[model samples]
Target: MVRKPLPDYYAALEIREEADEVTIKKAYRRLVLQWHPDRNPADRETAEEKIRLLNIAYETVTNPIKRETYDLQRAASSRKSKAKPRSAPRVEVPKEFMMTPLGYPECFVRSLGRRVVVHSRSDDPESNFQSFFASTKLALWWLPEVNNMCRIRKLGSKARGDKRGAAAGRAGGLNMAFDPQKAKTAGAEGSEVRMAPANKGQKADSVNFVTKASPTCEGALRFESASQRGQYLAFFPPSHLRVVPFLEEAEDRVLDFLFVDFASMFKFITLEEVLQPIFSAEEAGVWIELAKLQDDEAVKSHFKEVMGKDVWDVEDFQAYFEGHWATFEYNAEEKKARMRPKQERLAKQLRATPKAEEVVAAVAKTDESELQRLPVGALARALTALAKASSTDGEAGEATSAQIQLLAALRAVGKGEEEKCDIPAFELLHSAEKVLDLGGDNPDDTVLVQRSAAARILANKALKSASAIEGGMVEAGFTLPDVVRFLLLPGAAGRDLLLATSCVKLFEGRSIPEQREVLRTAKSRGSTNTAAAAGTALLKSLGGGGPGDHVAAPDAHVEMVAEVAECGVRLPAATALLRRMAATANPLKLAEALLALASRVGPGQAEDMTHIAESLASKGAFGNFPIKTILETVLASSKDDTLAALVVPAVPGHVYFALLVL
Candidate 1:
């Protein structure tokens, strides 16, 4: 007996296998709306079939038990199919359709009546049918045809050669009559235009026009009737669109027109599949705003915006897709390089001015690119100058001010790539102020303090003798107690735990006695923060609970927990530190944090991690994160089936997601 093949509920619903309940419902609802019979009356039969399959898929997937059973069956079926002998299918391969550069080109052929709507080609505005007509803003499809030609089908039409004349043509199709001889004459003399009468027994009256660029207007197209001599389709008076005589000077004349692309495809694809960039949905949809395409200047601007080129064509679009649209990415490094001169100017001003705060304020006001370009060496000198100046007065306020500037400059510099700084660790630590003075009055100062502390940790790691940097820090008056305080601070904000954990990690570089001091401080404290507790746990886990016991570096799990906590998702149990990741963090940062946490998960922790991930996800812990980013994060991180159960919706209707998953 043969086992029945399991149906693909996920495919029918148009979602990923790991899609959570929320994603399933959303996909179901969207597909229902799109394929509802009432909404798609023109294709009611197809809509009905779609709605039926969608209901089955939705019902199966939305139920936990049914979905589980189905998933199992699907997995078994997949394995069985793979194990079976490979056999070529009997069905013939479909012909491949090359997506036109003009993007679906599915638009209505609206006629511009003789009232001079846009411009006056003739000296007299009234005579120039080429220039003006009011747009009805009505939409229609410009279906593709063979030999660089297309059929201009009206909204309700199916047949092309309707012989029932104008009324039938309006109801079904239009027949274009073109006289080749007369067309040549009209082209040469720019005088008269005429077409031969329709031949007998032509059932469909549909007119086909050769697609060509308009000679009169840039980016606009002029459609001269294929079967008629010099006759072109134009909007008649009273808003009726029909073919008439083309005259260089007359009441009725040929004119250029615009095309508006619509989502017209010969085959069906899920909304999610369409949205994925890897699918190159460009072929599936037509070009953007037809009005822009019709204007010479607008075309240039459009290409520049999308492809980073002042001008582009069909070939360029093809190449762009083939290269995965890399040109579209904004290169901040290049942009920052462009602002190098501005950064140098600011650094010069910083060196010249004794009021470092004013320069720091100027740095704050400067564009991120300019700040990124600011020379690290120059910044170090300015910081060293501030520290030296503050030391002379022995004023706490002046010292605090220098530290404040240090924090601001470090934060700004931190925004760019770390490798760009290029300064040696010793020089940076020696030249830049080592102490993080606690003297600010603002409530926001705590956050700045935490971030600056974290930044300091990162900076110290750059030292040549990173392990013994504690000695240098002590000499600079930032003692072991100060490091302990940073590590034991409440993990209330995104960077608080990060600062704390980073501080604990620094003990690795300290002497054994110094490490003992950190452990003793934690034990001595009445209330211990998460980081201190983690250190205690680490000491106990490694069988060293005694005072003389040596503390080891933080375990991978501890560091992972700290990192996730730093992303504002507190762990052991995933709870958010902030109201939303979107409020403070961007998508890239959030994705990185989640993936980093995931990558550290051992096999034994997969189930717990999945639950934590799911709970965090259900609570919107990730914020208004992009689906593509999350999908990429998930795909790159893990292959654990249990973890895969943590559903995150990707770019809806993107084929790229499907392609990548497959």
Candidate 2:
């Protein structure tokens, strides 16, 4: 039985649940300074409890799994204790929005949930805002936007609940001041917020827009529908161009004529850096007039004379603008500027992986798709932690949507790049049946689940996934269909029979040719040489020393023996497999392996065969074997003279088989 719950650590820590990790750490360190046993002599008992609770909370929330579980339980208990109605979903904050010459736009949710996009100038009298809203009973719920933080409030008026105010956070510490004594109108989902007239003392003192803020900075823009969509009238932020005195629409047309709408990617950079001495306030007025002229001849001459540059094409102007502005993707589905992964990238990445810190940082940036470069365990941990950090323990929230979207992104990056997970699990499989806790359940049923869970957390080559090791299906991302054809396979040695039989059944619906390709990759290449030897021993152990032991599924063993002969055979582990295979002494295996290697060699292809022969000779791979059995087997397969010459390539005037099969 589970133990009773411990005391809540957050209460002891004396911080909000949403406190940042660094903030939490800072708080913890502060407590240690104030209440550590060495420091607290007057009230040691209380300090002891406080310290104990603080440590427990820090450990619990910092860990992803524990946090997730704790969040779930805590949320449930909180909901049960408090009687509160669920809040309605709201539109996401903008990633980056370029303020039109008129001003920054405010998005509002209409009664029926439609969006009304509109902008207002601080200096534009109340009449302009009233005319814009015109007969719509809507309220402007102003929020102070900080550097990329999107914390939406529920059931609380900012003026009363939040003491700090910037009306709307502005450059140079200037902002609108909110009057809490004024009217408040808010509602639940499907409810409308009635509009009220702009009251006095609510507007900015004056409008001066020559600002140092980046014109466009990013925020959490949602690609999906927005509740805060609205219509916009000609408006502009009061900037250096405020003195230009041109009609808003006339100038916005020329500036944003070639604009693209790259969502969520644009970032703001200050214009002061680009326009310092190049374009003074007086010069900006002249440029505006040139844009409004509509006469090509007059506009061209004036523009060139003012900016000190001759106009080339749209590209040239776009380049110039880019130097002074932020970039965005177009609304039309045009070619993207971002780079995609190269096709040959996987060839090198098969063995390479990112460091742990890099993986975690990718998660923090919410660019979780790059996690494909990380190990499975690390990927799981980072993703889980990111999901946990953004969300509370209970019902799905905005953070949950973000988490699911991140998963979709990560899935895309993992496509076609996976299945190189070369994890070995032959020994583990042999023992899986014993270690699995079936809870009085069937071992066969539980084995697949146990193996999959292990594989998901397990890292390393030859140890990726159990299914990957057995069936070479490592490329199959995140999908596991474990079907057992037999508890023990027909012809395979040891537990490899389990995999072989199960593999055949795994893709039961596939064609025979397809199945064979799948089976070969899974069993032969996925498994280690140690597993190969165990498979070899199974036939003899079953008292079948001949081909009839397991019916010939295919005449070729796919040459597990040739595998031992080639490149990997020189390793110490490779030497051991060779010795064990010799001791097992299965002639059918020998014949098939010999033919497979022979198949590779021709008169000109003697180098590989010679190397194999030397490795076998060095290992004393063949001892007291009947030469006639091999000779007859080789001769039977070697019908052509050229083919026969492959076994013993002639050198100068002599033919010697490298002392291997002499």
Candidate 3:
């Protein structure tokens, strides 16, 4: 059952339903002042009752949640009344246009046995109401374009009775249309509106343009079909709808439609609704020229104030409104000039702090190379300052500048030969590992470049010691996939050694089954680096490398063999699979086994392995193997020394062998 309706608060306040927050507050204050009990001492009881109702109304409407709940309850009551049968017989009234709750212009049309009428304006009642005929109402959707062009559609019979017009939204209705050509005749009127088939749904034919009424017709407006020249939509002497040619003399008696503003029709209005048409015109590049024709200073100043607040508050508002003088008169260069002092103040504040002073002074003087000479802890402190500032949700351009400076300092400190790991630089890497790990997958391109550079520097230093790798994983909270992504960087110095060393340290002290689970967990993360790294680590664990390679724990070699055994091979048969793979004469047999291994894995795992193999093979690192057939054929078939070919000078590579094992 529907609940009882909320009290008529808006009627009590004597304000329109679309009154804004400022207006609502103003109305409440005015009512309270006029009906205060002290001001009406002779009738204190009545005055106090009036003041009490006014306070209740004001409280309900001002609180947003209360107002929303009140509106819902009121709407429910209205719908319930609409659903009930009327006790009295129907009364025939004149056909007229009325505004729906959603602010569409609709005219009622009588048809068949049904009789309906829109509530006509009481101030200007129709003189010949008995002669009106019945038909469907047409709802007009005003489009954003030149001269207020709109689309008119026939509202379904069910929708016509709904005050909200919820059933007659923008889509799926019979529409009216007109030709594309503008009115060429020298007269006040335009073309006729034609009834368009519902199935056609073509936008071009349905557009109609409206014009402000001439002085003779006072507050009314006229709609003219775009293609039908010298005609206007009008009502005849007895209120019958028809398309008629324009005549200069007729005023209130004919040839004009009253235009009702949305504030009077819609129960609630938002700023978004008001801004949509204006922004549409702005985006279409005509708002500037249109505003020039009007000479309203109050309007221009109000708009400037609104847009200035947006420019100061929104992240990218400056880029959007830069140099648009007509709309908001915003200037990007001037805004930057205004912000220069604030940026200088921030820089001065940073320089006053002893921990950040030296780096800030160095950066201000454009001496980034001098930053490398600072102590490791000091350098890390400086980097942390800049990185934290850069990652803030501040203005986009400021963050970008901070990120650029951070990268420059990083490059200066990290610049050295790969063979000689500088003591200060390695210590800097240790100190800044947290900062590097904090860099996530930000959408900004500069952030990604900085992250890749930091990762490369860490990968270079971490390759020298397994303990550093373990520290990064266990203490710094770096996952195996994180290390894998760092190792796969384009500028990383010793990726192969780092990948193998990191994997061994990560999977150490765990069982063969636990190690397999770890590898599965890494591949399941859905990162290209994790899958490729897992495959490469697995191949290295198995005895896929040459004789000079370091031997792992005995059980590590059996993990992939177990993976293969699960794919329809018996355990005893799988134990000799790798041995037979090395001696197989038919490369197709090796290719089939690789395909079967890939088929049992997750999506994109095999593809990632193929890409890594192809990229390395293109650099001439993998000898005597056809580039196209490298992944298909076993790398074990190659010459013994070639299987351990290096990706870089210090890093022995095994990814190609891993691709074959898959």
Candidate 4:
């Protein structure tokens, strides 16, 4: 015959009975890698089959206890096969009869024990005995006995044969007709028989019978009624003895059932596996009590441990001991009692400040390293708050103190001096200005300090020359117009001043629609005020007038003459003023006044006069006509060389005189 192949699990991974877990694992790994689906996707079915077999073989051989059990079963099967005879067919006994064979003495004794008691009565004693014997035989057949060496006994007395029969008949079949001599002989031969009249209400005297007697049975019997003992009987043989094994099996089954129920109820996992990893002993105790409130001992014990000898009070537990720190304190009777209220009050005060949210968020997010390495957002917020507070008017003193504290903190964090906080400094100045403008209390003192601080910072940063700096100063309540004018003035000396001048010039040149764009561009380039100043200077240079004027007159006029004369440009000055008078029909007095002043000035003061005259001419002014006439006449009457040269040079005088005459 062809031998069947070993199972695929055994074949695939080459696992043997001797293989250890590591060996099994290595073999499984090798096989799995060779047949992995990703590596051999086209032949997936075959690969998957191989993988399944490998897993099964590895699992079986790697587990020591399972391997041992498998080995024992395999060995037993092999031994049984080897011991069987090949020539003869093996006779199989029913499992129930395997321990006892038919025709054995035990079998006959069992059959005898299987006899049931039977009763009969008749006027003839022989007929009554025969009937009883027939019923007993039928009972024995119905329930066969397993052992042959069994016995029976009959109790009570029997009468002599014919006379007993006659008495039994007379007594209405209640008496037995057994011969005492015969019963005595049977008893001597190891048989027992005795008879007497049945009791008044009973049908028969007594009966004893044996079937297959279990070791447990010392003549065990069950009776339907002691009063009707002759009515019926039932017997159990050695099978009754088997009840001990059956009962033992039942007890084991019951234990198994109980174990199964327990496994289902409690889950088949140890305390270590299911509970211990997740919770510490104390936590577990708390959890168990929480789960089962009816567990009074657990609840009480847990409360004591958590609340420190207090009776269980939910409010107290929650208030004082709910968290890991357990720093909170609670009194059961006084619900509001707490430890460290002052500290809590301080915390609340800190939180109630305007920048508290920002501080809290920053603090919450900061780790120890971050807090140490950088300025925490909280410090920034606190500084911002102090700056704001300092900027407010009535609160100046407190605010200044806060600012000092803020500066200390900044220095502690290595931010250097106060000028480092430019934005905050500017904001402080602006706030002071507002307070002062609104007539807030003692605003002057606050404004002065803030402006001084701002100026210092601006100087340090070289922002004074920046047009953007002007914008900031303007925001800080320095009037933009005044700031621009100040910047354009002659004495201004920084690059930021030049920049501011350039910005003002650009703004003036731009149309209304274009001005905002230009201003934005200047601001973006950090030159807003520079542009403004440049525009203002251009307007002034073009004789377009200052910011106070809408229309500007030509240079050949009274204001222009005054400007030119102030600059000592006497000719232009005299010409511009005389022309203005001629146009307006003014008298000669103003013209004469301008000429006289010009004539009195010596050559040594000529430069000064020129500067003053130029300035006056630029203002469109000239003097009165009488002085102009004198200047013309004098110029005309000059004699000879140098004097004539000097006289000829007074051309502004002649021009002024001619315009005045017009």
Candidate 5:
């Protein structure tokens, strides 16, 4: 009948004895997750066993009634061994009754007394008893009651005469023991007292036994008080008792039986059973799900109803489940303390931004670590500073394209329009400037040139902000003068005129005097070459080319041609427009204008477009422009078709030959 001592429930779960239900539940969940066969593939068998033990421990010990009973048995067995040093006499006993801790009760003396000497740990705790077992014969049984202890008396006729005197003498002179149940109930606040009467009452059997404990008695040599209430049941509690017993015996023939009705037996348990929640099993699943929620309110509301206030509030339970609050708080505080200096440094930088240019330089160099060190405020301040620098440079030392783009990016962040196209003006100009500079690495890179062209619009749009911040002046980095100057550079004359023309907006608010000076400087630097080129550009620009491609130049600028032509009172805008036609207007349209003008002007009333053609011809600038185109335009508008025959004979051979060759 010897079996292993009951499993150490506390040790199985690997938690302290003081652990509360919350802690127990948490520990169980953590272990299950860690050791589930799905997660612990390498040591699945071990994990399974461990989980099994955990389930058994959690289910058995977490239940108050079961755990209480277990503790009493353990303590009782400890006292029995300690109190009785002497060996028992050899005598066989039925094994259905519980075994002593050592072996088969050491050695049982079956004759004489039927009582067992109960040795208890500490002050022997007792209780009004209950016995649930019944043998093949209704066994002679005695149970303690509220007021008096029970004693066994012989039932056979020969021993009946020895009843009262011998029984009183053999009572062992023991004091009535304290009821462990009452002591427990008195100490346990709000605990419901559970008292169920014993299954069979022996007062009805008064006719059965009347003798004192004697040497010939079959049970034991002495009778002792029942130490615990529930432990009185020889096999199982009255509620759990079943008449059916699964009978078995070993080679030694110790009578053995199992009370199959007890659901709390360790052998009846499975992993699923222990893993199951004791109370609110459904609520347990909800608790786990709530932990996954990000919204505090939802989680809080759920916890409010699911776990009543008597147990925990939302925050406490959340903290408990999340792990120790003290540790988390300490970590958070340490993190804050560690970051304080850096945060202060950044705050100071944002407040003043004295060295913002350093951050700009770092960004330009693509120093990622340094950039990362720049907080959002610091980054913004530095970017603004760099933007100021770019605008401050204007035409002086233009910021590189990279710096400008970075500034634009910062501005986008500031505007909360990173996903949109709220570009900064200075950035666009700088971008174009960088593209132009890229000519060194990429000789004649056209796509970059086009990109540079497109960037010009963003640069222009970026200007209002830049200009307002920089005192509302033109801080355009790439100037029309620069484009003009670029053309004036040696071997650059007439080159990239489309490129030069692209920068027209750079002259937006220039004074007439500035315009005059620009043209004057061009003439000085390029002689007649620059003036003629300027004149040609001016002519082409005056409503002759694609007007959409050109930004409007200053009104003062359109007058430069009239000033250069010295046309007093000058041609009307229409005439001037036609004159620009020589550079880009349709040949027929120019001829039509020529014929119209010839008919209206008598050579100098306002120096109209009367001689623009012959003037540009003197400079030999009609490499792409044909003089005959004008002639043909004039002749075609004439109603007199015979005038061409008269004019043909008067034209020079080379001029005539040039017309035919064209």
Candidate 6:
């Protein structure tokens, strides 16, 4: 007879009733991709119908209740087929099975309910029967298909109310056997039966034996007494009857006995549920062992599994492991102390070397003009060499030389003296400006040159506008001296003069004192070397003072004297201005200017001015000299001057004694 066709949806999807949602969805994606009408236009109509049916089957089977119902119907149909009588057909066992050591028994049942009869084992001894019953418990316990059928039957009876009374009777039997008092109390409320604990004084109603119905059978069978079945109804429930083992002999094995008793007590339990506690205990033990082996090869294996080989090669991973171990061994204070110096050393090395591609890029982009140049690739190589240099004293000497070369290159950039190099002048200028503006330990001389060059650039750019020049100079931290020097270059002198004159005019009222103070400070700081030269040049340009003409006083003498004196030293130009003033016919004004000029003259020059002093005395200008009056008028006022004046006793004493004698 031909087998009845499976449901069209099932056949379309090629899935069993037992297929899970994930399986169904997978099958659907595959079938839809293959047999969808769009994919197979030649079979469009049939493919479309198949696709529709597939969708319906997937939807129906994916729903839990619908899937379960479908499974039951399929199972019932299978059972009905097995129950039907069939004409005997010639059966041929596969030769491989016959050649195997284990032979078929007198009767054997296949998974699909096909049976084979063997006349040879039917009349076998009772001892063989006993042996078969002894080994069938594990086999019976593992038959999921048979257990599933039993579950469905039990559920079906309960749904019809017929199994409720039977279930209640079983629960009553269990209560009477193991928990009579609690059972009586629970019975009043019709509560569920509780399984007896292993330690409880309860004897198992039946012992399950592992038996093969035939030598060729792969699984075991289970049996229960008609009266004891109620007490162990959940364990040997009708749903589980197919796989139940017979009680033939008592075995002292705990696992075997426990499995039998457990199966009888919780008949409705799934195979997975039955094995859960034991498997969970085993899993927990395995985890404990795993945790204990954290430093073992197993841990390495696990790491390999989770992170792959590359993780161990990473610097961060190495650092973390090293740090972890270091921390474990050393206290916080020790660890900090040990790490601090090493970290600082590492950072120093990092800074000294260009570690990143971007830093290398920056170095490459640097533009060193004629005044400031360095080979970019050579610098990088030097840094890399320094990075690799040993920290030992001998190696350090070589490293130091390398460092000096690097610093020299940097300084050349600062000085704007390097040949056609790529270093950025603006960066060097800004760095120099920062150093000067912030004023720290004496900055490198190259830094000063850089500041000077930057000031010159800015001043030259701003030459037309005095405000712009001052703003640029001030922004660059250029001292007034720097401005003067920057402006003194051949092309810049005229603009410099204009700028200075404009500044004097603009701040004549509000900032004259500040301007004077800045010039005064610059003078004290000996920054007026350039300024003095520039002023003398400008005076000569105006024709008031000829070169080497000490007899003539320039028209600019008052301002020039103040500025030059503020410079705190007398150049030849300044001495010429002083000599002209002292020789004037207005001897009093001349003497005053003479004394002012004398005050600023260095001691070495003042010592050589004895005749000038005697001349001032003969003119009687010394008697009323501001120097001598200060000696008697205020003791404190003479304190500094008296000491300074004594260095040239002829100048001070002749003026003072001449006043007394007169």
Which candidate leads the pack in lDDT?
Answer: 3
**Among all windows of ten consecutive residues in candidate 2, which has the lowest summed lDDT?**
253-262
Candidate 1 local lDDT, residue 355: 48
| Candidate 4 to truth, TM | 0.23
Q: Residue 338 of candidate 4: its Cα lDDT?
A: 30
- Our tally of clashes for model 2 stands at 37
Using lDDT, rank the candidates from best to worst.
3, 1, 5, 6, 4, 2
- Cα lDDT for residue 197, model 1? 26
Weakest 10 consecutive residues of candidate 6 by summed lDDT: 148-157
lDDT agreement with native, every candidate? 0.40, 0.31, 0.41, 0.32, 0.35, 0.33
Task: Report the error of model 2 at residue 448, Å.
Answer: 19
Tens digits of per-residue lDDT for model 2, 467-553: 454344333221112212212222223334334433432342333333333334334544433233333332222222443312232
| Candidate 5 wrong stretches, greater than 4 Å | 1-461, 466-649, 657-662
Per-residue C-alpha lDDT of model 3 across residues 514-619, encoded as one tens digit per residue: 4445445444433333333444444444543454323332333434643543333232333233333323223333333433443343443434334323333345
RMSD of each: 32.3, 24.6, 24.1, 39.0, 31.2, 31.6
CA shift at 629, candidate 1, in angstroms?
56
Query: What's the TM-score of each model vs. the native?
Result: 0.20, 0.22, 0.25, 0.23, 0.22, 0.23
Q: What is the RMSD of candidate 5?
A: 31.2
lDDT of 6 by residue, 434-496 (tens): 323211243335433443443333333333322343454344344444443433432354343
Q: Which of the predicted structures, 3 or 5, would earn the higher lDDT when compared with the native?
A: 3
Taking the tens digit of each residue's C-alpha lDDT, what string does model 5 give over 1-662? 23334466777778877788778776766765566544664564476567656655665565553455455444433332112111234233232232222112211111113222222111111211111111110112333342223432221212233343222323222111223444334431211112111222422211111111212222222222234322111121111111111122212121211111122223222212222222124432222332223233433343344222233334433333222211111122222111123233443333233333444333454534434444334443444454344333443233344344443443333333222222333443343344333223432334333334323333333333344344332344544455444433333333333333443445454444444555565555443444443444454445435644333433343345444443221235435554444554333333434454544444342343434444333333223445665455334334333222213233345555665665
Candidate 3 vs candidate 5: which has greater TM-score?
Answer: 3
Q: Model 6's lDDT to the true fold?
A: 0.33
1-662 in candidate 1: lDDT tens per residue?
12123457788888998997557666766776677555774665476567656765765565443354355434533431112111121211112111111111111223232121222121122322212212212222233343334443322223335555333333333233333454445553232212222323332223455444443323335455545545555433222234555543333332435432322121112211222332232443223332233244534443344223344333332222222211122122222111113344466445332244444355445665665455665555455544444333345454555456545555566555444334444445544333332343331364356445533533433332232445443333344445555334332233333334434444444454454455445434322453453443333333333333122323332343334344322243322211122133333453444565565545655655555445445545333556655565456535656445445554345535564766
Where does model 4 exceed 4 Å of error? Answer: 1-397, 405-451, 458-482, 485-506, 510-536, 540-662
- Candidate 3 has what TM-score? 0.25
